[model samples]
Target chain A: MMKNSLMRNVPENYNPYVSSDDYKSKKRVLIDKKATNSTVEYLESYSDLFDKLNITDGMTLSFHHHLRNGDFVFNAVCQEIKNRGLKNMKLAPSSIFPNNQCLVELIESGAVTDIYTDYANGPVAECISKGKLKGEFLMHTHGGRPMVIESGAIKIDVAILGVPTVDKKGNGTGKIGKSACGSLGYAESDVTYAKKVVFVTDNLVDTLDDYQLDGKYCDYVLKVDAIGDPNGIVSGTTKITKDPVGLKIARMTAKLLDEFGVIKDGVSMQTGAGGTSLAVAHYVKNIMQERGIKGSFASGGITGYFTDMLEEGLFEELYDVQCFDLKAVQSTLKNTTHHVMSGSRYANCFDDNVVDKLDFVILGATEIDTSFNVNVTTDSHGKIMGGSGGHSDTAHGANITVITTNLIKSHMPIIKESVTTVTTPGADVDVLVTERGIAINPLRTDLIEKVKDSKLPIVTIEKLLETAHEITGVPQKIERSKEAVGYVVYRDGTVIDTIYKID
Target chain B: MKRGTAGTLESNDAMIMVKESDGLKITITSIVYDFFHEQIENVIRETLKEEGLTNVEVICNDKGALDYTIKARLLTAISRMEEEK
Candidate 1:
């Protein structure tokens, strides 16, 4: 009774209705007739929904990463599968955070053989780098993720949506609960396409309308006492290092902003949520305040810091794909100037996107070589570590991409003779900042000449590398296994680089 | 620099009247913003329960304390209160 053709001819502006052309189109696809009725099913617990759904091998399961490191749902569900002795189920998460270390155990148990995610960090990335998972790993941008789901390229059998707040009707919202994480945009596509959608929440309300996510799409609602740690949701918003060394780097970056003449009013900028990047924002804020300048917009993973800047009239608008703090959530909910953008709109290189309009973007790097090739993933040991996220897209799109970091970390020089893996090409990076000095990429001679007389210390890329080498000596090259554990795909879905297992 | 100089400084009620740290003043002034907002009471109750304390005062000169900062401030306030006799 389920129409297979309904998914094929979905209109440009399709609304969820049974009789509309869109509904008829969806009804034509009768793969499973029993699932057509959108009725509410009260599940006693998550385990009950898992049992009722009959999750089997080769079935695709999905999860969202709104909770970041504080999320316990993914690991909890995967643990249940491991306990049930399930195998070969593809794990398609919106993103994976560091706290989901239990996924390493699930991978070893053979319950999850394949993974498709926008980001992966910590032990899971390490495990994947070691070629631990049996199947291929695919990385998609936030925008591409929804596109893939909508196109039916990656069919999701069951989507386990972790709700910070949910009603009996399975409607959920992340903006108004104890674990409120803001917009449910990432899970919207999954709920629409998945054969069965399950709502897992720690906080359940008396009515469905209280939930922010549309309840019409959900099939079952299961409640738990505590869903995720509120602290972890905004864990990335810590203060950047105020060390004199970091301040010097930040000053150099700010000077670079001045020299590029991109420090004028109405310029748009984006920066990572790292300590050093946040430091750059702090410095930029001071310059803006001093110069009496206001920016046009700020974008990317928005934090309360950025929202406050917007609220304080520092920026005219904020384009947020995902909010990093509760202040951001409150701002997005209350302020009209704060806009929510899809991942594709945020950083999909295949599409004409907003990142292309950014005047400057301050990024963090684990290592950079003289070639200007950057590596945000892996370490000197070639161990699988970080994630690509929006690094490459933003680097390529931003008018001036400045990579700010200390010359050395933990006695290891960050400017290495050669980077372990190239996440962003050197051609895209405009400047590199060290505590000692700033290095302009050779391609930006105009920038080089413009800053010639600036008081900020300017040095050659080679000199910065030498400074790092002087302190740490030469680093030992890591021996890598021939087997590819995971691949870092550019925003266009091309294999930019691959990570191998460290022996 | 007597302990009792900054108010009646109890064991856990210590206060240091030092100069403000150098940085942006990310101030957050939250006073149950929407009184009739759904689950407003529940959020406050849950926040207190999650923080694991009874009574405390939080004075924050926010350089932009995000949601996490607000929660952290409350948590710090509660923990400071719990440490007292």
Candidate 2:
């Protein structure tokens, strides 16, 4: 069995054997010195690169998911491995998206047996959900990912970073290419900690005066025809939900932000890209405009709306860790105030990150219990779908963590007696705004007292639960087998919950 | 006899279609139907009653619309149906 020293005692029903603690960092005797000329080394093809590296079985490979559904590096590297007849390699990616379903074939063929990730979705996630893989999966949070990698708990053999634009000397940036993806935050840890790092890019410019990633972190530079699909690299648009109910919830959330003085001048915020969160941005923009309030910096997964705010002078700057759409990508290219940040600087709890400076954050959830505990990792059924990619991290860091979601969704009441899996502890969550009303966590007595006389409906979480139950009769508890699929590690490196295999 | 419709198939909104019917009957389909079915039905009923029309059929597809939006859409649909007549 794989042994792990960093693995905390997971809350019942999970296999504690994560991975062996015998992680040996790949030793580097010397750093590459700058040459008089551009002495950057390049590889002709993936075959040549793999042949030179002599990749063996059971070696761990790492990747970042900044490109989302557009990335080609993962597939290209995996296809090379398959062609080379390699097997049992541990696939460690920051996250897996719908386009990474090619990993299903890699797992089925035994090219990849083990997986480590902060998040996983699509076919590969489904494969792991069904226990189709030969080995266990280690699900870490965004902050936990860099923590483990940096602490030498999970040594990476090779990390392949895909960039949008690159120079001949391996200097690269995701901001100025056809497939620009805003920030390379998720790739930061892998580049810094991996034994070997490769820079793969499609837009090889003649010369780059400055780049986000310097050539110092790279060992090899490979040029591909297309690093990723630009269409998928950036969404065409990030529109707020037009649903009046969603609008109402969003309006109430904005009102609370303003009432609580979270929307004043020099405010800092982080909001997810879910419909309601986007709507919150829209309404918050209106409030900012109406009040003549300008914010200090807006951070996290940025969308066009946030970029528009930056341009409109609502916010002075944007510390983008990930761009959610094309407009955000465009803003990063030309706007110096729109800065790209590494994952460690973005939300890693071990470091002083941007999340620590956040005054307010708007998030979404699949389920929230009466205690305000949130579940975003699994569905109503006990299946593996998502992992915490800065969910709990921002929740822990933000001054006021607000969860905005419909009270009921897909015929299931979102307000449950207890969540299926506690991804974010209730103590970190401060408020919940639903279409029906708003419920403040009792722990935040200060906020409750402040908003007590607000025109918005202020109700107890128990009352919300009662209303939900009255609507959708108490739902049956999801069934699960004795087998554990994954463990949900909190932002601070503790195993808060264990995901059981769906029965 | 007149027929009118309001709203769209948006993420968090609902659409209501009011048609001249022989009897008072309301059909509500929603993403959150299990929880908000009754509340949505009440909004439609009260809306139609205020319009002084109990002989019309109401077809509503809800996308988690709040009570106010539901009432507003119902009233708008009724007003359009009246304009058609």
Candidate 3:
């Protein structure tokens, strides 16, 4: 049984299906600190680090996706572990991208058995969806991962962080380096709470003046040839869609935002990095320029477009959790108003964060049902393609949550009778805007009444579904096995839906 | 064909033509007609009735305009037709 010093009435193996209200108020364990007086040796090779750390079977390890698809440290560490023949270890990454496909060999060799992550794409997710993993794949939201770890539900034996710059004393930062990927926010918990923390980087500097990760949290620091690919870490720029239909929806969305009266001064917002969602930013930019309105802040996955808005005085500040493009990285380092925050400060539900006070958030959805439940995890056939990185977290926290997607994607209707899996509950979602029309959740009578006078089309989700069916016809149901392969856990740690095996 | 016509083919805006007739007759061509035809026709009819003109022929070429934008365009055409009276 895990000992929770914060909660007095915690059950053994305390994992419960509780509501957000119940879960958010639970006691959380404080992070353990390591105080050592002797001079600690920080430099080591991969083999020496592994042996000294006593890499063993059935232990948990963590990694962060701040390096994104350019990351090379995860594969390097796993390779060393596999060479040492460690087995049955659990892999908890903040998120997994296509570059982490090397995990396939690690899983097949029995070196990795269980997996937990906020988001995943490409081969690893496909392998997990096919039940190739030894245990069920547990999916979490961006906020939920920190929540579970702080509650002592999952303990990490070691946390290997891939940083861009580090000193001899193990202090590190992702702000300035040849392979800089701004904001080491996602790895904050691993360094703070893990039993052992290791910093692996390619660029070694002599100074410790400006560092995001303090040397106290990290036990060892290792320098390598390359930590990540520069081209893959951050794109040159983020782009909006050229599709006319997408632009039309973006226009309507901007108009709707104005009608809601939240587009004025002091409004706080967060938008996804999708094409359509970025298009919403473009239209919103025009509206702000036209009205001379300056927003309080724009947060979340920061892109170059947002940085441009900051320079143009469209937004007063930009709160960046992760930098998605080069311009965003440069802006966070250059601008005083562009602030870098830890993951907990960004979206953890147990503690107060920026998400709790957001006025609006624009999200992308793969499927949305008549009840306003959303599925950003799977495709029409229930294959894993995306995950709830922060979709559910922001929706749960924001005053108004709007999902933007085309009515039909690849000849299949997006507004279904029900989603393949519910990533964000209907109660959290406030509105859905497609190219055809906008549907406000019946639960938000305040929004419906607010937009009732606007010329914008306000219709029921049922009406949108009917219109979709009229265009695409009823889609064929997806087939899957009876056994469950994955579990979609809501941000509060409740199992909202089960994903079946697709074979 | 004796009527008043105004506006252009701008995106998200509408062009309309109004002429005298024995009864109210309306024709609409819109790229978004499938989703908003009823809305466009209602706005056109309401605008004509609000101006106390019942016997008229209204032709609207809508390029996905909203209800209010369509109504404003129709009213502009109605006032133009009255200008030539």
Candidate 4:
């Protein structure tokens, strides 16, 4: 069995993270952008669309994840492909949530030989960890996804998008219809890069006052009976955490931000769609309100909580790439200040992006090493569970990136000597906030000096690790494999870590 | 005691079910079983030995519970078994 408890660094094949200043540019995928064609086929069948696209074996088919876990189009399209006995097809969805469990079967049947995505969870993730996948799994960050595709490293044969509403000319809006998801940010890159773009919608209107998807980019439109449920956006946990441990960490992180003077007026921040992160946002919002701080904007997959801040005039605008809740979708419908942006505009570090403008950002972790390298990609057992959606992007861009999590999660220490996989390099990371104690990175001397004489429980990361070890005891080494199932690609288009298969 | 149960299936806790058995038998299922299974088994065996109880069956649904928690829960179940007798 492959032992996994040893102190391992970046593998030989991969480039170790040196400094964010040492970053290099990636390949730029070329798109032949043109005006709207005279003829746009509006069809009602997936089979016809596939046939029209002339899909063959090993073709790279892509999809947008705006529908999230409630999405019906991704599974439906993949199922049709499987039913046609297609093999070696490349599945490149922006991200895979739990509801897309059809992928588990697709992998098992050898129908999907390769996979590329920003994030993945549930059965598909578990399946990949077991090494059952027949080919390479390319894990990209939210921002890096735009980079990877635009650079031509990962090409799209066809882009199948599940939009909520589409007008007669193929103009689409994600903010209206029965299953409005609020933004088409992720699908924009696909529509531009893919050889053919298919817009699948259950609702078709004669005209849309504001459409996110331009008809010129779309080659075909599929009108389905139902696209997906809007409610699935909140299928996973994204509520403000009520757990005392979570609340404590959030409060401490907010206090740290205040002490560091990051909570001043015109501050720009981002947080993960997790309860702990949202709790941190909640605390930050309170701080903004108390100080009458009118921040510039909040960005990413926005939730109702963020909209509430915008509605109350706390922030000037909301940069929504995707909506996380129904309230957020409603906010987009009514609030003009709540704007829609493409994925590249949201976080493509090569050009002007939202994440780069962040003053401070709050993130969560499955494991964080003493060096501050994080692993939101795998569990302690070296199993695939999640990938970096925007973890590294925000961390790399934000001046202060705070990681908030419980010290002990389900009897496992959140702090480790070395993480199983490095999703975000330690060089970009700023601090770690746990319920037990807060650890400031040695590299961040400026932050350390800000709270040197504070009442907060500031301890070395090693001390926090010792406290956790004392409680959970030393766990046995987990089994792993020499054969890597996938690679965690950094925002800079460099391979940072390899996820070994479970032996 | 004829039968007893203690603790909960919550994280960092163990839900232990105990019933009358001719000899000591412990069956465990845990989320962290890969890493701490042997240590968990040893703790349960030692806890039983210290209690001077031989006739018992412990089924521990462990969600990464510590050694002391296992001992305390087992002890409570043992006390409940005696209360029934």
Query: lDDT for every model?
Result: 0.70, 0.81, 0.82, 0.85
* Per-model TM-score versus the true fold: 0.74, 0.81, 0.82, 0.94
RMSD of each: 17.6, 7.6, 12.7, 2.8
lDDT of 2 by residue, A197-304 (tens): 788888888778857777676778888899898888878998889889898999999998878877888999999987789989988888888879989999999999
Worst 10 residues of 1 chain A by lDDT: A1-10
Query: Can you write out model 4's per-residue Cα lDDT over A243-309, one digit (the tens) per residue?
Result: 9889999999999899999898899888877888898989999998887999999998898889988
lDDT per residue (tens digit) for residues A255-316 in model 3: 99889999988888999887888999998888889989888999898999899999998888
Best by lDDT: 4
Clashing pairs in 2: A243-B12
Ranking by lDDT: 4, 3, 2, 1
Candidate 3: deviation at residue A109, Å? 2.8
Pairs with backbone N, CA or C atoms under 3 Å apart (clashes), candidate 3: none
Interface RMSD of each: 21.8, 6.2, 10.7, 1.3
- Which residue pairs show backbone clashes in model 4? A27-A151, A28-A151, A29-A150, A29-A151, B1-B81, B1-B82
True contacts kept of each: 0.00, 0.11, 0.00, 0.70
How would the candidate models be sorted by TM-score, starting from the highest? 4, 3, 2, 1
